[model samples]
Target chain A: MKISFPYMGTSHIVVSYLFEKLGFEVIYPPTPSKRTLSLGVQYAPEFACLPFKIVLGTYLEVVEKGAEILITSGGCGPCRAGYYGELHKRILHDLGYPVEMIVIEPPLVEPLDFLRKLHKIVKPKGIFNLLHYGRIALEKLKALDVVESTLHELRPLALDKQQINQAYIEGLELIRQADSVKEVIEAKKAALEMLESVPADHTFKPLRIGLIGEIYVVLEPAANHDIERLLGERGAYVHRSIFLANWTRDNVLAHGEKDIRAMAIPYLNQMVGGHGQNSVGEVVRYAEEGFDGVIQLAPFTCIPEIVAKSIMPAVSRDKNIPVMTLFLDEQTGQAGIETRIEAFLDLLWQKRKKQEAS
Target chain B: MQAYLGVDVGSVSTNLVVIDDDGNVLVDLYLRTQGQPIQAVQEGMKQVEEAIKGKKIEICGVGTTGSARTLSGVIVGADTVKNEITAHAVAASHLVPDVQTVLEIGGQDSKIIILRDGIVVDFAMNTVCAAGTGSFLDHQAARLNIPIEDFGGLALQSEASVRIAGRCSVFAESDMIHKQQMGHPTPDIIAGLCDALVRNYLNNVGKGKEILAPVVFQGGVAANVGIRAAFEKALGLKIIVPDYFKVMGAIGAALLAKATVKEKGETNFRGFVVSDLEYQASSFECQGCPNLCEIVNISVDDKVLARWGGRCGKWDTLSKTG
Candidate 1:
C-alpha cells in the first residue's frame, strides 16, 4: 500500500525514513500550499481553526495523488485536535475516498494499545528487530533536527543565501536517498560542514528571536506563512522550541524536559489544554535563554492558545523579554506579517542599544 | 531644508505627511483610496508638492506603512517600511510624551499598543474580523441615511445608551435595524453602535493588555466624537486624540524615516517626480510547482521593479536577481 502523511515542516522526512525501514512504499505529498489551504477552506467548517483546514487540505491533496493509507498523531485535550482523526475520516469518506487512517496517541494514554497498533504497522519480526528499528528511527530524527538547526544558524549570516539553501537541499536529498544508517550519518556530517563553511559576515550580528506556540503552526511553515524563513532573511536567528523528535520523546516516552514544566508552574498551574501549558513554559524558557525577543504563533480562535496568550503578558512583563503573538487564519495577509516582523526587529534593535548604553 | 516623507497607503485611505528634521509636520494630505492605491498616492503626492510649491524642501528619507506598505514602498523608494502598530505607537508617544497606551482604529482594522517609557513593550492588531473597525460605522451610517461625518454628532445627542450586540457586524446590523423598528430614537441607536464598537475593540484587540493612560486614540475612526466619548467612558481615562490623528501613521513613518536617514546619511526616495510617472501592476500564477502561487509584478515605466505574493521565495529571489 502507498502510505501518505501530512507535511508538517520536516516531520514527513522523518516519518518517510521510518516507513522505508518497514519495507513499505511511502507517498510524500508536496508541501502544503495555497491550493491545499483552499481545498481545506472549501471543505472545513467556516469557523474551524487554521491548522484544521491545512491538515484537511493536505489529506485531500495526497489522497487525490492515490495514497490510501494515512497516519497522523492524536492529542487528548480540551482542543479539537483530539477529534481530528474521526473528523478527517468522515471528511474523506464523504468525499468518496477509500482510506485507512492510523491515529497514534501518546503511549501514556494507552501503552499496550499504542504498541500493539505500532507493531502491526511496522510488522517487526521480534523484540530485537523492534529495538533496532526504533534506534534507526530515533537516529534519523536526531540527524534531521541537527541539519535543520544548522540551516537556521547559517541562513542569516551567509553572504550568499543561495549557497546556504543549496547545501540544505542537497543534504536533505542525501538523507532521503540514503539506504543505510552509515550513509545517513555521513550525510548529516556533510550537511553540517557545508552549513558551517558557507562564509558568513562576521561584522553583522543577527537578532535572536525565539519562536513558540502551537505545534502545528510553530512546526509547519505554510500554516504560519513561512514566518521563520521570512524572519531569517531579515537578519533574525530563529530558535524554534518544537521539534518532532523532542516532542515524541517527551510525550510518548514521558522523558520530557523537567525545567519547562517547573518554570510554567507559576503562571500555568495545570495543563489548561493542548500545548497551553507548553506554550507558556517555552516562552519562559526562551526568555531565560537570553533570546532578544519571542514570537507566539497560533491559529485564530484557537482556544488553548487564546488561554495562553491571555497569560503571556504577565510573563513578558516579569521576564522583560518582549513577546509578540500573531493569530493566523486564511484571511491573514503576508504584508501585515512582514511589517510586524520588521517593526519588532526595530524595537529589539533599540532595546539592545538602550541596554548597551546603560 | 532637510525633511522626511512618510506615506500610509491603506486599503481605505492613502495618507501622506512631510515632516522636518525636528519632527514638526510641514504638510499632511489624506485621500480616499477608492480601490486604487496607485492613483491615490500619486494624487496625494501632487497635492503635497503643490502645497510646498515655493519651498526647496529636500527629502532626506522616505518611509511607508499600512496594508499597502510594500507596494507603496516600491513606488516611493522608501527607506523604511513598518507596520501600523509600531507606526501608531511611535506617533502617539511623540505627540503625547509619557503615553502609556494607544487605541488606534483604522478603516479596515483596529489595534492596541501598550508602551513603557516611550518604547512599545506590547501591541495587538485585529484584521481578522470587521466588528471593531471603521468600515462597520461607515456601513451603518449609510444605512441610516446619514453621512458618516454626521453619524458621530447624532450619537452625542442620545438621551440614554442602548445595548446592541457588537460581537459581529452581521449581528450588529440586524440588531440595529431591530432597534430602529421598535421606535428607538435614531441618536440612541447610533450611540449604541459607538458603544458597541468600543466594547468590541476592548474585548477583541484590546484583550489581555493593560490599557494605561495617558492614552492616545488615533486613526481614521478617531474623528467620531461619540466613539471618543465611548472610549473615555469605558476606560475611565482621558483619551488624547492628536490634531494629526487621521494622518498619524504617515507621521510615524516620517519620524522613522528621519531615524533611518540619520543612521545611513542617504535616502532612497525617488522624489516628487514619481508623481508624474506611471506605474503598472499585474499578476500571474507561477507554474513552478503544484502550489501554483500567484506572483504579482509591479512595473515602473516598463521596468519591472518588484515581484511578490508567493509562498515560496523562488519568485521573489528571481525577481531580485533578474
Candidate 2:
C-alpha cells in the first residue's frame, strides 16, 4: 500500500525513512504549497485551527497522488488537534477519496493502548519489528534535532545565512541516507563541519531568544512564516523548547526524564489542555536559563495557546524577560510579523546594552 | 546646523521631522499617504526643504519608521530603519519624559507600549483588526457629513452616553446605522462610537499592559480630542497628548537616526534631492518552491532597488547584487 502523512519541517525526512524501512511505499506529502492552504481553507470549517487545515490539505494532495493509506497522530482536547483526525477523515471521505486511515493516539493513562493501536496498523510486521525500527527512528530524530539546533545556534552568528541554510539542507540529506546509528552520528558531525565552515561574528555576543508555543506551529516553518530563520538573520540565537524526538518521547513514550510540567507549578498549577501548561513552564524555564527574550507563537483561534497568552504577561513581569506573542493563520501578513519581531529584537538589544553599562 | 531627518510612512499619513543637535524640532510636515507612500514621502521631503528655506540645515542622519519603513528607508536612504512601536516609544519617552505607557492608534491598527524608565518593556499590537483604528472613526465621520477634525467637538456635545457595538467594524457600522435609525442624537452616536473604540482598544491592544501614570496618547488619531477624552474617561486618568502627536513616529525615528549615526560615525542619508527620483513598487509570486512567497520588488526608475517578502533571503541578495 502507498503510505502518506503530513509535513512538519525536517521530521518528514525521518518519517519517510521510517515507513520505508517498514516495507511500505511511502509518498511523502509534498512541502505545504500555497495551494495547500487555499484548498484547506475552502474545505475546512471557518475558525478551525491552521495546522488542521494544512494537514487536511496535505492529505487531499497525497490522496490525489494515488496514495491509499494515510497515517497521522491524534491529540487530546482543549487543543483542536483532538478533533482534527475525525474531521479530516470526514472531509476526505466527503471529498470522494476512499482512503484507509491509521491514527495513533498516545493514551494519557495506559501506554499499552498506544502499542495496541500501532500493532493493529502493522499486524503483519509484529511488535518486535515495530520496536526495532522505532528505536532507529528515535536515534535519527535525535541526530536531526542536534543538527537543526546547531544550525539555529550558528545561523545567527554566521556572516552569511545562506551558507548555514545550504549546509543544513546537505546535512539533513546525509542523515536521511544513513542506515545505522554510527552513520547517523557521523552524518551529524559532517553536518556540524558544514555549518561551522561559515564565518561567525566572534565579537558579537548573539542575543538568545527562547521559542515557546504549540508544537505544530512551532515546528513547521511554513506555518509561522519561518520565524526561526528570520530571528537568526536578525542577530538572535533561537532556543526552542520543542524538538521532534523530545516531543515523541515525552508525549508518546511517557519519557518522564525532564518534568517540564513541574516548572509550571508556581504559575499554572493545573493543565489547561494541549500545550497550554507546557508553554507556561517553558517561559519559566527559559527565564531561568538566562534567555534575553521569549516569543510565543500560536495558531490563530487556538484555545490552549490563547489561555497561555493571557497569562504570559505575568510570567514576563515575574521573570523580567521581555515576551512577544504572535498569532498566526493564513491571513497573517508578513510585514506585521516583521515589524513585531524587529521591535522585540531592538528591545532586547537595548536591555542588553543597559545591563552592560550598569 | 547639523540636524537629523526622520520619516514615518504609515498607511494613512506620511510625516517628517527634522531635529537639531539639541533635539529641537526645526521642521515638521504631515501629508496623507492616500495609498501611495512613495509620492507622500517625496512631497513631505520637498515641504521640509522649503520649510527650512536657506537656513543651512545639514542633515547628519536619516531614519525611517512605520508600516512602510523599508520602502521609505530605501527611497530616502535612511541610516536606520525601525518599526513603529520602537519609534513611537522613543518619541513618547522623549516628549513626556516620565511616560509609562504609549497608546498609539494608527489608520489600520492600534498598539500599546509599556515602558519602564526609558526602555520599552512590553508591547502589544492589534492583529488584522480595524475596529480600534483611525479609519473607523474617519469612515463614521464621512457618513455623518462632518469633517474628521470636528469629530471630537461633536462627540463632546452629546448629553447622554450611547452604547454602540465596536467589537468588529462591520458590526459597529451596522450598529451605528441602527442607533441612528433609533433617533439617537448624532453627537451621542459619535460619542458612543468613540467610547466603543476606546473599549475595544483597551480590551485588545492594551490588554494585560501595566498602563501607569503619564500615559502618552499619540499618532494621527490623537488629533481627535474626543478619543483623547474617551481614553481619559475610560482610564480615569488624564491622557497626555503631546504637541507633535501626529509626527511622534517621525520624531522618534529622527532620534534613532542620531543615535545610529553617533555609533557608526557616518550617515547613509542620500540627501534632500532624493525627492526628485522616480520610484516604483511591484510584487510577484516566487515560484522557486512549494512556498510561493509573493516577493515585493521596489525599483528606482528601471533599476531594481530592493526585493523582499520571500521566506528565503536569496531574493534579498538578488536585489543587493543588481
What are the RMSD figures for all models against the true structure?
2.1, 1.8
Candidate 1's displacement at residue B234, Å, is 0.7
lDDT of 1 by residue, B1-322 (tens): 9988999998789999999988999999999999998889889889988988889888789999998888899989999988877888889888899999988888888888888887877777775677868888888888888999998999999989789999999999999999999999999999998999999899888877888889899999999999999999999999899999999999999998999889998999988888998899989988887667778888877778888887656776644545
Evaluated against the true structure, the overall lDDT of model 2 is 0.87
> lDDT per residue, candidate 1, A230-299, as tens digits?
8877788899988778887876566465677688999988777678888899888888889899999988
lDDT by residue (B1-322, candidate 2, tens digit) is 9999999999899999999997889898889999999899999989998988899889999999999999999988999999999999999998888899999999987999988888888899997567879988888889888999999898999889799998999999999899889999999998998999999999988888888988999988999988989999999998989999999999999999999999999998888788898888889888888888888888887788888888766787764557
Supply every candidate's count of residue pairs whose N, Cα or C atoms clash at under 3 angstroms: 0, 0
Best by TM-score: 2
- Quick one: how many clashes does candidate 2 have? 0
Measured by DockQ, the strongest candidate is 2
| lDDT tens digits by residue: candidate 2, A55-166 | 8889988998988888887774456787788888888988899888777776654567676767665675666776777777888999999999998889888998887888
Per-candidate TM equals 0.95, 0.97
Instruction: Judge the docking of candidate 2 as incorrect, acceptable, medium or high.
Output: medium
